[model samples]
Target: MSVGKLPVIDLTPMRAGDEFHKRALGDALREACVHTGFFYVAGHGVPQALIDRVFAASKAFFDQPMADKRKVDKALSAANRGYEFLGGQTLEPGAPPDLKEGFYIGEELAEDDPRVLAGAFNMGPNQWPAGVPDFAPVMMEYYGALLELSREIMAALALSLELPEDYFEAFCTEPLATLRLLHYPPQPAQPLPGEKGCGAHTDFGGVTILLLDDKPGLQVWDALNERWLDAQPIPGTFVVNLGDMIARWTNDRYRSTLHRVINTSGAERYSVPFFYSGAPQHEVRCLPGCLGEGEQPKYAPVTVEGHLREMYRRTYV
Candidate 1:
């Protein structure tokens, strides 16, 4: 695999239940995790129809006039959700806004819950656009379905860690999840100095499951080689990557390489990502197998909520 290029791994047999097939799946995952935090997961049982419906709805949503979409602006939630207009985002420092617009969604939890405290990880409620008639329903349905699929994937992760497949269950119940929809218009023939669809940055949560349209211009950084590499979307496949917490939990056995999106295409590009995170207040520590032997604990334990608050405060505010 080229440097900065996300490896494409076929995940079919990994989901298989036969005891005879377990080792193969484990090996595949182990290689992927340790080498490249990014991979194309094909053969995971998510329905094509659901994925299609999501992208289709995304197109419709982005096509609406900016004013119409802004009717339910995230200004209320302080831009935690709702819409982000083109040239309105940047995760990289000293860079212009990303050449894209998007909607960020997450699980709806009670504001009074401890998880919703000012310093809590899941404090924000969703900011929705009332203009789109079925927006809420469609999003909710898609989220529920993806949530199940994510849990199944997490089970495989548990197995890979040599623990009971239920290792990630604690994070799933009342999961702190996010669904982000992105639209990137084509870059102008003569582009601005530092604009990109998305700046190079690593995710701050657990794992991110992304559904990208069949477009060119997305790239994942290869830690091995310092360069930008393309991430082309394949039909019927989803891209998965580890975030900060998962990388920390594994004692850096897994790599969380920095990735970015560039609108190199002559035409617009669109992508939707469902970010699965955990209760911010939960403490994250290296699992026993990850750092028990040769690997000494590289990082001390930190509460998820506190870590999240610090990250968000830096990024958002």
Candidate 2:
């Protein structure tokens, strides 16, 4: 059971009717947000049964023959909106490609939305497998719920940072999102040069909310220890971590750590991680309080479109 050191915080019922409950959760978030930049979110309203259903669907989808899954492969489309099978690189330099196969889907958008058409990665329509019944709709329902939950957490983060509760709300409406259904098959009989379940790369979105199975490959870098620390799954909790965009918004106050997935034990693993980001057209800049009065801006303002493009350039090329 010993994987590695990790952090967890229980946020049960932050929207409780009692005022004390709200303050306590907010205070806890403030402390953890500043120190860890990642924590477990419990008491999030999503049902356990719903999660189990999604996990089941995910496993069934990946269980199909590789050739069948590739029929909907994301590589087949310029939209980047379908399956990215096993052995895809993380787009980081020198690091190895991930050993997992994934099904990536984002919000279905109309071309008229200037932001969706212009922004990369997220805004396109998802490719559904005609063979799988109700697959797309159920996944969409799950995504919708997580998006709502992310918004609530963002409000709390804003309050923790001593900013307006809605400071991030407007900019995040219909944000760019990704619901990645991942499956890491057992380690190959012979390993590649640098292959692992996934390479070390900080998430590019505002925050990553992950629902992981009890597989032991997921590791988050411990800044203080400077080592790859295991992140064991706790049932009833979603592991939430700050990503590069949130780091920028906070003026680097919070961290964006290097995390990787490695499975030396030869176990097949599955995880569903939701990458929640700002609205496609929103511009991200350091908040006033984070910058302080008359203090120099730590980061230049950049639109979501520009920031993501630069990230893709750095990682994809």
Candidate 3:
């Protein structure tokens, strides 16, 4: 069954064990994944109060003086945790730098942790901004909530792919996830050519769960029509999209479509995107049922860490 221009899926059924409902959930997810790689998920159990606190903390932190914000700049940590200045990244090669500032948060590990000692890529203690009192607590709480929700979504994805519900259990263990808070200023009247709040690019991880403010700016590419479709924000729901790893795992059976943002709402826009990249050591190979008879895997196997490192190199180097 088609779910309109962009599907709005209910996760409430996925939380229960009724076979019929589970299968129906899987079917809906499969439709979204195979077609647009985007959907809106409702009935996710995160509290609205906690979501509000997160947004409030984000704005409070961003409103701080530049000197205070720069104290925890991402450059201070090799693990890529902390604040990122506006235009710090260019997601689309050859396009102007992205016109947004962001902050990154990840699992809190101590300096002497084994992972940190081993110099693991993007693995280390998070640097918290000092001035925003509620920033640390609210963000950590929201991160925990999103992390658990992502595992449930991953299970649904496995079911959609005709695999067992726990097919990604190993992959979810000790996953490498990132919670990013972004602020996009209004689009300039005469912006630079190809400039945007974020550039046209596919995400690099397994999945992304994005929370948006009431302003519309997100857009997903409609490859079939060769046009971009606005992804309007809907209250009480989060926009979900697949990433490159899913496409690779399915041998391209599922899309990891290109998307971007442009803050044309004439006001600042704030969003939170949780990137659920599975275990750093998990081996990402083509799934068993993804290939046709006598067809070989299109890409060689790579560990999650290896894939992430390569993607980071391409974008940040």
- Tens digits of per-residue lDDT, candidate 1, 44-99, equal 77788777777777888899997888875666574277887777778888988788
Report the C-alpha lDDT of model 2 over 1-317, residue by residue, as the tens digit: 23563455555544653556666666778777677677888878898888988888888888888777889988775668788867775644675777888898888766566755675555666787766667887898899989988898887777677676677888678688889999988777787777778887898878899998877787777676666667778888998988898888888877777777787657788999998887877888887667656777778999876788788787766
How many clashes would you count in candidate 2? 1
Q: Which window of 10 residues has the lowest lDDT sum in candidate 2?
A: 1-10
Task: List per-prediction Cα lDDT, in the order shown.
Answer: 0.77, 0.78, 0.93
Report how far off residue 17 is in candidate 2 (Å). 4.5
Which candidate tops lDDT?
Answer: 3
C-alpha lDDT of residue 252 in model 1:
89
Which pairs of residues collide in model 2? 74-83
Q: What is the descending TM-score order?
A: 3, 2, 1
Clashes of each: 4, 1, 0
TM-score, cand. 2: 0.91
Best by TM-score: 3
